[model samples]
Target chain A: MKRNILLLLVIFVGIGFLLHAWPSFSQEGEEEAGYPTYPIIFTKPLKAVLFDHKVHVEKAGLSCEDCHEDIFKMEAGSTQQNEDFNMDSLYKGKYCGVCHNGEMAFASNTRCASCHIGVMGYERLLKKQHSSESSSEH
Target chain B: MFKGFADWVKSLKNEGVEHIASEERRAFLKLGLVITGVYAGGKLLSVVSRVREVYADIPEYVDKYPYKPHYSMVLRTDRCIDCQLCMEACRKTNHVPPYGWRTRILEQHLPSGEGQWTRRFMPILCNHCNEPPCVRACPTRATYKDPETGIVKVNVKKCIGCKTCMAACPYDMRYFNEEKRAIDKCDFCWESRLSKGKFPTACAKACPAGVRIFGDLADPNSRVYQLVHDPYRAIWVLRPSMGARPNVFYTIN
Candidate 1:
């Protein structure tokens, strides 16, 4: 009976890890109702560049197909690993510059503070997420 | 020997070139010509004198401002993300066609250390210069500067589509609009929005970064005025040598 309890504990811990690791996959169905308020964080050139999907889609009136399969991939954090994933790429009319250019949107070069969010904004988001997670557990 | 030295000094002073009459010296001074650099007759001097004549009527820069509501734009160039929201807003507000753009962003790259690179973006549009070349070049007076607001506006009714304004623009901002059959460029959104009581231009309103600060330069409280007038800020305009005296200013900060 002791062996059985240990096995169950291990199984519960593994499941918890899986849920935490893949929040997007687990929360996909729920987020559909909320619609595009998700903040995507990128770690490059420095940690925590926040891209708000809600502002682009809901406020700016852009569709999913507008960015997907063209400028960026559907998978999150995939572009960060690419060799040309930095500001250089964006300036060349790739990535975010595809829309952010003054011709299409606000040029990426003009507003460094708005979307850069920086490491501080990243930490704040992380803290908010941690507190929410702990509170939810309680 | 002392008497001989004094006599020699007096003789040297007497031998000096004849002094000009005081009235002649006063007349030269009145012409604002310094003697050291002045040559009475030369082709270059004639050209310089004619150029001075052309500008002599113009008032000092500080006192030359004629517009009451001097519409101006200050661009914070470093913060641009190159999102095209402003472009879309312009098109929607002004009905700009697919082939034409009133404003555009230019990208430049500089190599940082460790094989990394830095990207910079600059947005360009009609500068609406105080001495607009486009307005002066237009034969039909199709493009003219609004005296009250200091905005360069295209009178489509008067435009013959000679494209003189397009060629004359140092910024290359004007384009011959096929639909309008006139050279169209940015008018600070005067007809579409400004005249309709909107404060910010379409592009400025759509800019998420607050990169484009648009306001009246005459207003001391306006951000545009503050940014342009700030001593700490490195403010500059494009191609200042062209003598456009652009109302639009750019700042790195």
Candidate 2:
């Protein structure tokens, strides 16, 4: 009876280990769900209006899969922001710079005052310039 | 005493004849006691080991979110193309490497006897349950649900990436990010988008079939809440009887 009980215990543990056989299982599932968010850094002056993707999706009679297209359906915080977002390079069509370069999506040069107005997180850029001007004035 | 000890072991080894002859009716009690003592000792050792586990990867998020029986994304079966756009969209939105898929659309072809083509499409992702089993299996506090949004999230930065939550999950929703050596899964796009003042997951946003709907499950005015509350709508979850009490709802046509 004692040996049988030990064997039963061993079976339970064996089942548990078998149940958790895949080491990459949970993480693969988690990654599929969305785990970590890779940080993005900007190397160029390419800030757009805070596009509330939800407004167009839920309230505006649009589906969630529209504006996001292909890229929006990616993992969280994994977007590459530092990719060169310039107009000359963008005009040829690359990243957000390509279409937003003025012809296809939105104009890059024509929107200086748009993002530069401060609501687009470019206020920090302006503040730095302003402080530099004041300091050089002295 | 040493001679006596050797004699006892020798007797046990040669037990076929002498042991059987020596055994009496009362020997059963002695065997029973031995078995119970062994069992008790094992239990004590296991409890101690569990208590002393330093880097146990348990879920610390069970105490975080309040329970709810509704979910956000609803699978509209009739509109599904089995294209797996949602799965691709989720990867794009999250930048998930090709190691594994977080969301997948399952296709089932009916036997060709009905004189009509019937392909069943099932889009599966984490159901963000009111009581997620993955939350219990984690020995470390890596997996947890968000309080404000009620979405399940893992602290990938802190996770040792143990597969405990995967075992604990009845829906088999949890996944691992082998590249980062951590766990990953759906946060309903709420943790990254909604809570961060944005909205629409990549899967929900890029859904060409318009089969998936992402909304706040909390507010009555939210599209997801309305969908969940719809009396005529038939909502379903994977293994609804498992008692995980998931918040995700689906409209299977």
Candidate 3:
């Protein structure tokens, strides 16, 4: 009877561990399904800017059809290749300015560091990526 | 007896300012002075206080521009995008090592609303303060502020490398250069670009955003002067309470 109690305790702890790690497991599943779960960092014309698909989709309640192939192409970083991908273009109601026109969202001119993460943010992101990769290797 | 005296004073008629003529009040108001209170019972002692309009950051001494050129920089803080092109130019021009930085960008996450935060990037460099604490801390007399151009410079040969200036610096702009065997900092590109007949510093020239406006503060026509002197724009300096009297100014367009 003592041996059976020990097995039951082990099962309880195992179930607790899985419960704690359930969110990360679901995130991994999303990544595997080509959901663009990771943040897309753009580097062109300037050092960096950040775009989060999860924030747009889940938080802002935007569907894939709203932006995909209409506002932005399906492939990431492709828009940056064009010559008019700079801030002047944004002010003229192009790219991010399409929605961020002071009505739907905050104007692109204001809250600069929100989108333009700058070189420091770029370096921090690189460091995070390196650490995560090294931890995965172990 | 003192209590009886106080009671007698209280019982006396309290003559209000109705006797004072409106013309006298109007004259005082025109001179930007207000007669706040009358202390000596009558109009004999009127506390006329001057209503002086003063910007806290712009000190009275700045109007003199002690140095001839009075080299200064006005930063449009809002325009800074943190691309780090200025930093790269400074590194290339000054030969700053990978570990060391002449200028740096700091990030701040300020709360915008409920559960939301806004990011701001602040770029910092040597302010070349009028009363530099680093110059005061140096034991070897290695660093000195130039009287002609007002640029605080270092004489590397005289430097003892004691690192006291590094500790004394309010802005944390100085670093020990392993190659030079002395403390190095941003000289506003004096040694690299300015001394070579170049108009503006490398960092200022390299910035694509036109954030750093470098010019003589003494000159009325210069962009730096106009930006700082503008009444509408709010101008401020970092660590003004330190009493450094920083030449570098920050404003938003």
Candidate 4:
């Protein structure tokens, strides 16, 4: 009876530990899926724009292969270096327009604020990052 | 036998529409009354008797030009990206301190749809109102609307720094300049640029997106006049209910 009770106690403790560590374990799993867990922020050509890998990958059901090596380079923000990487280019079925052509997703011209978070958003993001960093340090 | 008519009526069950379900009541009420919502107290309910009309009429000051070169600005609100280049240019040209701002961008997250929101940046500055509340509120006559250009200006020498004008301003555009020891606000870059024969304000010139269109409102050919006068375009000023008669207008292109 004591041995059975010890086994049950061990199982209950294991379950409790798993429950406690679940969030961090899931976060690690997301990172291991080969995409950055944090939203990628672009600052070039404008103050800022936000791109979420999770939104495109999980929500929109897009794979890395869909955008990689063709529409966008494997390296992030590489498209921004090009002079043609702008709204005009997007309207002409290039870059973001490849998918965001009103059919696949919302057109680039229609919902501008969705991506263009602007200077204020950029500053807010910086503040958030700073706060998170300080908190983690503590 | 019944005692009387009053006593007989009182004896009957007091069944009114009060016991009806809210959904059934709403269905009945939907015919004439537009029920807005039930308030927290549960006693207070709001109903819109008539459909609120969208801005269908032209602005009051379409043809009226009181000042000779009535300086005005029309912001194409949708075009603004909140890059803040205009703010930087204004600061550099006008020597605005870090603590103070003659112009600033406001960020808003407007509800786009159910469980969704969209971000927008609105740039605001001194409206240079036709009937400036700040001018009327000034005890020392330090702030005045210029008769020549219609630009509201502050006379720093006359200013006692009472900040009455700051409080009176409907737009909340005025801020105290600690260095000057006076309440400072945007004069449409008149002291720095416009008086120097420069057509547009520093902020207007610096905007890469062509968001700010500054021109003489009196001139029929000017872009500002055309944009404001466009019958199809919905031109609106901030806080129109305040009736400050703001010269600055906002529109989306």
Interface RMSD of 3: 1.1
Candidate lDDT scores, in order, read 0.76, 0.56, 0.83, 0.83
Model 1 chain B worst lDDT window (10 residues): B38-47
TM-score of each: 0.53, 0.45, 0.75, 0.77
Worst 10 residues of 3 chain A by lDDT: A26-35
lDDT of 2 at B207: 66
Docking tier of model 2: it is incorrect
Per-residue lDDT over B23-121 for candidate 2, one digit per residue giving the tens place of the 0 to 100 score: 431353333311111122222111112211111112421122243423366666555544455676677777678877677766555554777544455
Largest DockQ belongs to which candidate?
Answer: 3
Q: Give a tens-digit lDDT track for model 1, residues A4-44.
A: 99999999999888766665564675377454445688876
For residues B117-203, write the lDDT of model 1, one tens digit per residue: 666667788999999999999999988999899999999999999988888899999888899988889999999999999979999
Please compute DockQ, using alpha carbons, for every candidate against the native two-chain complex: 0.10, 0.01, 0.58, 0.43
lDDT digits (tens) for residues B97-198 of candidate 4: 999999999888888799988787789999998989999999999999898989999999999999998889988899999999999999999999989998
Worst lDDT run of 10 residues, candidate 4 chain B, spans B50-59
lDDT of 2 by residue, A26-129 (tens): 34653653322122223234332233333333454645344243534343323434344344554555544534655644565443322222122334455665
Evaluated at residue A54, the lDDT of candidate 1 is: 76
The reply for model 1, stretches above 4 Å from the true place, is A1-138, B1-64, B111-116
The TM-score of chain B in candidate 4 is 0.78
Which pairs clash in the backbone of model 3? none
Question: What is the lDDT, from 0 to 100, of the residue A122 in candidate 2?
Answer: 38
- Using TM-score, rank the candidates from best to worst: 4, 3, 1, 2
